[model samples]
Target: MQFLFADCVLDEERRELTRASQAVSVGPQVFDLLLYLVQNRDRVVSKDHMIESVWGGRIVSESTLTSHINAVRKAIGDSGEEQLLVRTVPRKGFRFVADVSEAQNPERLSTDASILSLEATKPSIAVLPFQNLSGDPDQAYFADGVVEEIITALSRVRWLFVIARNSSFTYRDRDVDLKQVGRELGVGYVLEGSLRKVGDLVRITGQLIDASTGTHLWAERFEGQLENIFALQDEISASVVGAIAPQVELAEIERAKRNPTRCATAYDCYLRGLAQMHRGDEEAIGEAITFFKRTIEIDVESASAHAMAAWCYFWRKVNGWSTDLDKDESEGLRMAQRAVELGRDDAVALTRGGHALAHFTRDLDTGIALLDRAIFLNPNLASAWFLGGFLRTWHGECESAIEHFERAMRLSPVDPELYRMQGGIAMAHLFAGRIEEASVWAERSYRNLPSFLMVVALLASTRALSGRQEDARRAIEDVQRLNPSLRVSNIADWLPISRPEHIAVFADGLRKAGLAE
Candidate 1:
């Protein structure tokens, strides 16, 4: 489709923007934003509405938006002062004032005969639940997590259509033909894998096939010790993403490659630790820490193990699970630093280390830079985006923080840690003075994970700030129930923010929400 605005034309099919028949440079995201605006030019689009449509519901900085707007203007030979084509209304939102006309491309709209025939006949692909070859049936969570992670990784590439995990996992334990599976799942590709574990050694084999032709597109064998199970998983995920979307950067692919230790025993322990870490309870956290420590004991150079151990300690400090905060903080910082030093090339390791540094050492800029590098290396890494969001929020760039959080949420759509992302959104809205919007998001966060005390606190504060006294009081009560010794003064210590005004806004909200003096 061709979108004509002023003297420029955007060819959606070619993914190119042009001015007077000459090509103009524009990033994919900027192009998308411009297209969306032009398409919806009839009315004013709110920031939230634009975020959902353009960024795929990921939160981005106001500055980032401004930069894109500037780029769009420059490409169309307009300026902020001119406001000739696109206009930003203060306190409201953006509007596209340009006269736009849509030109159709008949060839571009033509459907593949095979695809059409299949649509009348059957759907295309099915993602089978990976078989847990780990003798311990309890290790099912690890196998399940792998499939989920793969589903998430594959969904990020715009060209590939993926079946949701819920729909894909429905065929668990059922055997079916690849062609039939494809028809059932409505996808052209089928991915099947098996996980096998014997003591410390784990071997995973995966194959990708074009269901329509019943041809194998790619296949690989990943063999590693349990100590490097996480690394192996990362590698497998990256390989699958690369095979499915060849346009992905070579640097990103290399960054996604995994090099786990040759020691099978340590690898097994590490996989066990990974499973426990996903549980995210105090007992599970302790068990994960023990297993990670054991992995490190067997392999002192295991950067992943140290990074996970530090993450567990950081979690403990955040959740008030550890009595010795100073000791935990010191150990977490040291381990995170060591992990970064040893695993600078590892995206996951870098993200964990960056998060630890940001939270424990208050090194916001350094931490953000590390996470950004990690994202550059692996754009599909959800944890890196999550860490970026958290750091940006702490640094008081609420708008940008929201964008990172939204991207992370999109990357891990079915992740159980969704509450964290929702809370991030709520915080951003709270800081932006959209109290009602913050309350709505806070409520969503609470509904998703009721035990999240921080979300409960934020919900109460939002309600109070919005002048809903009764609801605020109830939320405050919920907070007190979760943390019996809660008080207002200690909030500043628990909450991470660089600006006093930000803290003041939070405090005022909480106070109005009926927080204890």
Candidate 2:
């Protein structure tokens, strides 16, 4: 495979790079780095991804990495400052920003084996960080906050493929090309705007561009008071997406907007909590809980805050991150119950709190109902679909669970919760008694998140049941390394499988893998 951009050609088969038909001198590391970036050009590549792919997870110094990046830039007739082709996303690593066209065998192009294609299947748009035109610099946060609100609002539209913020924000503080930005993020439309705040008034100017032809689809300027920021965000998002896909049902966007808080400060706190929560580690989740609690203190009726807080505790209980399991479970149930009681109309709150209540309290019926209502209320809510799928797996409805899981995947193809979704697919297959299919899904999930003990257990069970004794034993060792104590009689204490047959299948597999009964 070869990539052509600007006056350069990068040939992967020959392991060569050229600028203006002249061979460029580059080390093996630099060549590998460039190839990785080009193949993953559809999204921002993280530093961890670079290390894992280029260095084989070996320890490499920061300065050395930066130096290699510079070398790659130079060879491609680009510079770190200009970033014409290679752009560094602060703290997020780098992206190949140039427009690249593939020149390769069609079969090889389709089966790169290294990259997951982000082809747009739905009407998609990326709202890049709104420029802070206020010149105060202090209003940078406000501008970014508005952009995030717009992104969140757009994400709720099921027919829209909204690029995640991290990928869009990679081009921040740089001279942007709308066509190039669209190509890099795999979106059809791009929204670039500026925000200016003065005293108690604010003005937002936005222009929507068709990246395919660099055509201006829509342009608008919104003027409103500081307190009316949320309303402006909703209007801007609705107008932008409405222009792109006129078929986008406005009712779904309205469903998502119903939970917006009256107090911006409380909303800010909730956003901060969310930022911390997405980190997916124990310590970050704890801090996220603190911020969420603060949001609730400011507005006791904040259903989203209550729901997020419940989810934090629920995560702690499930991931074995808490020292006092009983105490945490009790607290989590209380918060989740309150959230469900107050958030009957809010999809976000219902989805999060509903899953927490159902998963932790074993109230499968009510939990699944809440998730069902959430999906009906907002079909675009990917998490709701995924969580609902998991609950269905527990209810022994494998086919229905698989449908919802596929819907979730179609909505958010590159979802950060991909591991959780894959786990749901594994369980769905397990419930259907397809041991081989179950093993394939479980192994994929475990590879994405090795720390997930449940996926490791599934990998062991499926392999053992498929008569792959040696591979099963290796997976069993992983499960034991994650948790030493294991016995068939006590298996229910760890896994949530309720059906006797399903439990027996796992137990028998584990026993076959040399675990004691």
Candidate 3:
């Protein structure tokens, strides 16, 4: 389908958005949203309607919807106030108001078909839930965690569009044809795998297939001692990504490599903990903590596990699920420090450890150095880039922070925790004295995750600073409702920024946003 607006044309089948005969950069989701809006130009689409139509009714917050809206506007040189191309009718919803005309592009369709016929045209891939070949059903979590990691690792490549785990796992244990699966899911490639663990040895087998003709693109068997499972997974993922997207840079391929674990069981426990962490509830966090602790108990030298456990505690404190902030903060800082001391060669451990140190301990210089080293080791480490961005923003390096945040977004385009990156961007904009841009990013951050206290607070303050009094008040009310115990006295202490000016800006924004003492 071809959509023409102004001088730009979006060809959905070709997966290309062009302006003045030149291709422009538009992320996958933004492209999808644009295609939907232009295709249904005559309608007033509500948020629910758009979510159902665009996101296939997946569970996403209002913040996600707003981010897409902002993306679309940014693409078209439009804004909330201008509403030149897309108009928002308040509570009712949105409409595409531009003079758009459908264009017939036989050449574009032919080009798309030609590209589709190519061996690499298999644009879609699904990472099926790995079979728990282990005897104990309790190990199901381990197998599931492996599949989840593969999904996450693969999703980091911007060139590949991965089906979310929730959607892909629907085929679990179902006998289905690859061709039919491809047609149903609208993907050209499918990946299926199995995991078996016995004693201290593990075996993993995976195959990548062209869904069109059921032709194997690549297949490999990974066998290693249980202690090296993490390394084995990384090797398989890096190999697969390299095979599918040959254009991916060498630096990124190395970044895709997973750090080796000191013990296999510790890796297993860490994976289990990760699976539980996704639930984002107090009970889940507790379970995750237990798993992490078990991993550490099994292998105290497992730096990655220790750092991840510290991260869990950090979140528990932030979410108000833990009453003992002092204990949580102290333990998190200790584990992070120990992780760094033990795993100097491990980028993942270093990133998490640095983040904990920077946020919990307020050690800016040491934390920034650690994070920078982590990024240098693995440029594809999205979390490292994210933490680096936050640290840089607080250190008054707004441009550098934006660069890091943009890199993070590119690496993890569909990250479930995208609000964190957006919040970083908002903070950078605010610190750079771009009030309007700050307001935009702050709104986008809040739109992607309403329950994100940091984003809510940032948005409230940005709005107030921008002179949007009512909007600021609304944001403040939302934050107060979300955290009834919130008070001005404790905010500065809780905030991760180290610089006085950064703290002052945040506190001032909150004060102006009408936060009660």
- Top-lDDT candidate index: 2
Q: Clashing residue pairs, candidate 2?
A: none
Alpha carbon deviation, residue 498, candidate 3 (Å): 3.0
Determine which window of 10 residues in candidate 1 has minimal summed lDDT. Answer: 247-256
Roughly what TM-score does model 2 have, to 2 decimal places? 0.51
The estimated TM-scores of all candidates read: 0.52, 0.51, 0.51
Rank the models by TM-score, top first: 1, 2, 3
- Deviation from native of the Cα of residue 167 in model 1, angstroms: 30
Q: Kindly give the number of clashing pairs for every candidate.
A: 17, 0, 4
The alpha-carbon root-mean-square deviation between model 1 and the true structure, to one decimal in Å, is 20.9
The per-residue C-alpha lDDT of model 3 at residue 415 equals 58
Provide the overall lDDT of each model, using Cα atoms, as 2-decimal numbers: 0.73, 0.76, 0.73
- What lDDT tens digits, residue by residue, belong to model 3 across residues 1-517? 6788887888877777777776555545677788888888899888888888866777666765887798788777789889999999889999998998776666533433443432222245777887778787876666676678778766755335688999989998788888777766666678887878888777777787667678776666666675765676665555444344432222122222232542234444566676666555578788888888887665445677788877778777766666787888888888887778655667778887887778787777888999988866655677788889988987788999999998777655655556888988998988888878888887887777676677788888888888889999999998898777777667866666656777777778889988987
Q: Write the per-residue lDDT of candidate 2 for residues 382-493, one digit (tens) a residue.
A: 7888989988888778899999898787665655677888988997898798988899999888888786777878888888889999998998888777666656677776
Candidates 1 and 2 compared: the better one by lDDT is 2
- Name the better of 2 and 3 by lDDT: 2
lDDT score of residue 450 within candidate 1:
74
User: What are the per-residue Cα lDDT tens digits for candidate 1 across 35-104?
Assistant: 8888889988888887788677765667757777777777788899999899988888889998888997
Ranking by lDDT: 2, 1, 3
